[model samples]
Target: MTSHGTTTEECSPTPPTAEPATPSPGLYNADLAPTARKGRTWRSYSIFTLWANDVHSLGNYAFAIGLFALGLGGWQILLALGLGGVFLFLLLNLSGFMGEKTGVPFPVMSRIAFGIRGAQIPALVRGAVAVAWFGIQTYLASVVLRVLIVAVAPGTASWDTNRFLGLSTLGWISFLALWAVQMVIVSYGMELIRKYEAFAGPIILITMASLAIWMFGKAGGSIAWSTPATKTGFDMWRQIVGGASLWVAIYGTFVLNFCDFTRNAVSRRAIVRGNFFGIPLNMLLFGAIVVVLAGAQFKIDGKVIESPADIVKTVPDTFLLVLACLALLVLTVAVNLMANFVAPIYALSNLFPRVLDFRRAGLVSGVVGLVILPWNMYNSPAVISYFLGGLGALLGPLFGIVMADYWLVRRSRVDVPSLYSDRPGGPYHYARGVNVRAVVALVPTAAAALLMAFVPAFHAVSDFSWFIGAGLGVVVYLLVADRKGPFAEASGEAIAVPSKR
Candidate 1:
């Protein structure tokens, strides 16, 4: 599958004895090294678990069920989700191959395309996006927890009356409680997270299946899979496209920083195998069950309920109610850690390698998540559409530039040590540690994407900002980058990595 150019086959079976032999104060750090082969312990199941935990969250469940409200049938929703899953799966493998081969996280990998110091720009952008989502996820989880507490105690329900900053008094307590729990768990580091994720993934899937079964019985086994045939032709096609875009948007956060997890993978095969089961298969199964639940609920009553937590609240059985709530709590924590927490930690560490380690970076991430007051951002559909959509616009062009630089321009060859060097003529040190071509490509494309997302006239295409930005980035970079400059200088210098051990 690989040769000397643009393929992981060039990677050594084992890493070097001492990768740096000497560290660069500003660029190289212990946390940023290429993972050693011995420490690459993640199997195919680990990757599967990672995606399972990431996908099976309350927000995602609500999203899948909500597509029905858009007038898409069950089969139609599945088709859109299925196509989106395949699209994401292909990209994950492409990026995962790089991480498995190099054993470096996304921030370190960015150095290849963005230059060492210039790498900070993409890193910070990714980190900021993560910060916003972290808060949103945490708040979502807190809402569920508060529901559970109210169900159990009832006295705590009084606290819901008082409001502050768009959240109730109980909401503040619940949010802070979940926030602290996450801070403690994440500070312990990735190994603990890896272990918990493997355990949490299957349990959440089972709980979801159980919920579907109970809801199915509630509707007496009769549920509508499709709405009445209302619109046809181009209008219907537009909904399908929009549904597919929503599916992809659901996973946009992981697209840039998947390498944060894949860097620990035992092999590229593991990543590919895991992603196959984790994404398309998992998404299909999960969507099917969600269809059953939403359909049954609609069958029993004419009203539509989008939030799974709210659906759980309507359950007559207390045991099932408590169980679903707990499962959702675990599911959100698992996703929050893997998707929102880890990426920012790595990004922040990369930005201030001299001042921050993983633990410190995680602390900063938690604080920023709180500061963002994500409850406000998530309270309104308009806010969510503008805020999150705008953030996503930034990443697409960055992804395009990175992928294009690795596969097209340099042909996958990377100078490992030079990435850590600020030496005047170092391979990655292009014009004072910043690649002008990348910046130029990024600014215009990102701006265009933001305009599409924020402007009312561009609403039709706003959902496609990521694709537009990425395509533009690829086209612009290819046109502007110095094809023969760094690639020629660092032609044969494959990475000699030494990661965990």
Candidate 2:
């Protein structure tokens, strides 16, 4: 039987070539999709740099410290982190493979799953996710600056009581200051983001290393992880699960949007190798430093310090304090540019291709970031939990559907030319230009995930929220989809990946 004006036999052939690299003036933007660019010179280090850019932040550091509070000793925490990191690597590469194979950005690649015009649904949602995170990360990055300003001037502490929009006068200044520095980095664009990540990744690692060493030196000898909780059986396992969930949430934003980088990768092999070193291995090393820092905090101050700036403040040496603060500033700025800055540029560019480019979109994104009043939202642990967990719930379905359609139903045979076409009979222009099956599956599953996140009763199962949503989305989409629609595939076939166009 035919579906959507196409026969099953006819739908299983190789996809046609996409439009020319140069986008048309109306709705096509060069930055919105992959161009005719060929292979890249990027190596595994670039992947490492990307992870560094994504993870070397106050947010990640705080998350690491939180893991220790989960009733796990240092050794057990390390094991949980390693397991989570390995899974995270696998999840990332799934999305990365699509871009590497297709040479398209995430939104453009999404056309196959959601339809050319319908792709806007996922694009807008993902874009909004970027905005929220961009704001949150900006606020987190500025925390170091806030610590620095108060320390240097001393009287700046008064601004905390005399506040603007719940942020201190000094807080506002520091936030804006780092925000400006981030935009300056954005103005220089992706090359600078790449170069900065490559350069700053090592510096941040070294800084963390130095801090860890200093902490160990002053920790008064042996190091061991001890928390207040008395977790032994299921309780310990629950903590491990919770730690893994946090680990997933830490990099969850990137799993679906990773194509923003992998599409430009030198090879699939490089992507894998880089992720191995950059994520799981890097997490091991970075988490060790964080563990040590937390241990030292307990030794010296009788409390676990999660905030890097606060930890630095405890240092008596003037030079080390200033150096740590500066290193943090650089780290924060680098992360803000790499993770938060690049995705929104492409996302907004997709909406108004004729009107806005990456730079303009970036400027607009910063404005949106400020408008969200992220300052008020970011400080609370409950808010952070909801923010990251809730967003991950939404992202879970999107990622699941995309991966399901690409790898299973489509058999990787994405019709590139059809990704841009909105004609009634075009490959992706299903049911009035949207894939109703995908949306139907996405809504219910995503709602289920959201309920797990926000509802007080369901919070116990919140650790598996992303997994639940994604798994349900995948199963439902495959079951509901028309075999002759975009999901059509021949048995034992693989999507014939066209080389760099």
Candidate 3:
């Protein structure tokens, strides 16, 4: 999510403090604090590349095609995906500015609304959600490796014929190998991740564009758009809404976690500008390509191919198949390391501040993700729906709470020092380490949303759970919030982080 907010130094005064320990070591670990006022240097292009960083994965591609399974035509699916992209861009911009303005990560920014210590609740919530997707995405990435291995070494096909604990022997080998590859990249930290995206984004786009063009040519450059997927004449609107909602659910968690990325941007406009192209434009383009590819599959193969790996599997040219898999492998590794791995590391760090720095937190997150066997959870539509919807259920309320706190309650001013200070009665100090009100608001809202997600009878409403839960969170938080504070008005220190020497 590309969010909006002036960093604390940009718009709010520095609260009472000792020099903040330079980078705020330990209790106010500098890594977790508002970035230094003079250090914001990320530009618009950097922001645009983020979607490429996050979306260039097998799952994102499959998800685009899955939208068409709703029985909508290419045009309808495009519209829905584009609109969902717009919603994502807007929602992310709403949150992104706060990170830029405040120059702090999501959990740190949540202090005002959830309270300093209480902020951990949302942090852990997002972290757990990240872990789920992290493992799931990691598993999804390994599919490319599986394809590459089988394409090159046909004898390994027997591994697919056999099974153990939900995956075959070769599958297990590929998964662990891919997992290790990701761990290696993540260990190098964000700077390297940044460089990886910059390098891989263009190549991935070119490769997918080539595949789509090739498929379109084979299909005779024409597409027979499908009829309404779920309903007849007038009720087609419902199908479109359902499709759009699914896209939103896929997008829900990112907006909530966007602060982790936006905090690194040097200028507020950089994120917003990047988001304009990144979310709506990029999704439409990618979705169109996938829709065409799916449509082409009917002519080129037989049925709509669910996975691109299937497309690569059919390629008669060994060299071309290997090349496609290589692009995909690069894409998947980048997505796992950048999208799923980063936020969870921060979440875990927030959870055990003194004990777990980012590296240690990455170890903890990676370990937990491995134990969950995310592969078992990722392969089926029903399972994916339930899994992603459940995640959205948690995300919606957090998005609402944070948005409400930043936009309505605090009015954008934050006591930056108090966010890190251990002093009692500090601006964010509430109850004993937890803000009961935010909990009160988050629990039932999320519970109802979760039921909507997993309960078959309520499943029809599951896609909209994010929207509904967010509305509920806003109402509940508004009712319990303090009537006034420093953040009550939109006033603060105005200084940009200077360029680093």
- Estimate TM-scores for all models: 0.92, 0.88, 0.89
Model 1: how far residue 387 lies from native, Å = 3.8
lDDT of each: 0.80, 0.72, 0.73
**TM-score rank, highest first?**
1, 3, 2
* Candidate 2: stretches off by over 4 Å: 1-27, 37-41, 150-161, 228-230, 379-389, 485-501
Sequence-dependent TM-score of model 3: 0.89
Model 1: residue 141 alpha-carbon error in angstroms: 0.6
Those runs of model 1 whose alpha carbons end farther than 4 Å from true positions after fitting are 1-22, 164-166, 380-385, 485-501
Q: Which candidate is the best by lDDT?
A: 1
Q: Candidate 1 on 81-135: residue-level lDDT in tens?
A: 8888888898888788777766778998898888888899888888878888999
Better of 1 and 3 by TM-score: 1
For residue 389, model 2's alpha carbon misses the true position, in angstroms, by: 4.6
| lDDT tens digits by residue: candidate 3, 1-501 | 222334444444445343331222434554575666565656677788888656546777777677666576788778877778888888888888877766777878777788767888788777777788888877776777888898899999888777887888988998888888777767766666777777888878888889888888878986545633434565566767777777777767778878887777777778888888777888888887878788888655456677677777777798999899888888877777766787888877877788876677788889888888888877667766666656657888888988987888766666566566565655566785567778788887788778877788986777687888788889888888665665422222222232221
The segments of candidate 3 whose C-alpha lies over 4 angstroms from its true place after superposition are: 1-26, 155-166, 227-232, 300-302, 379-391, 488-501
lDDT accuracy of residue 7 in candidate 2: 22
lDDT score for residue 204 of model 2? 89
The TM-score that candidate 2 achieves is 0.88
- Candidate 2: lDDT of 220? 84
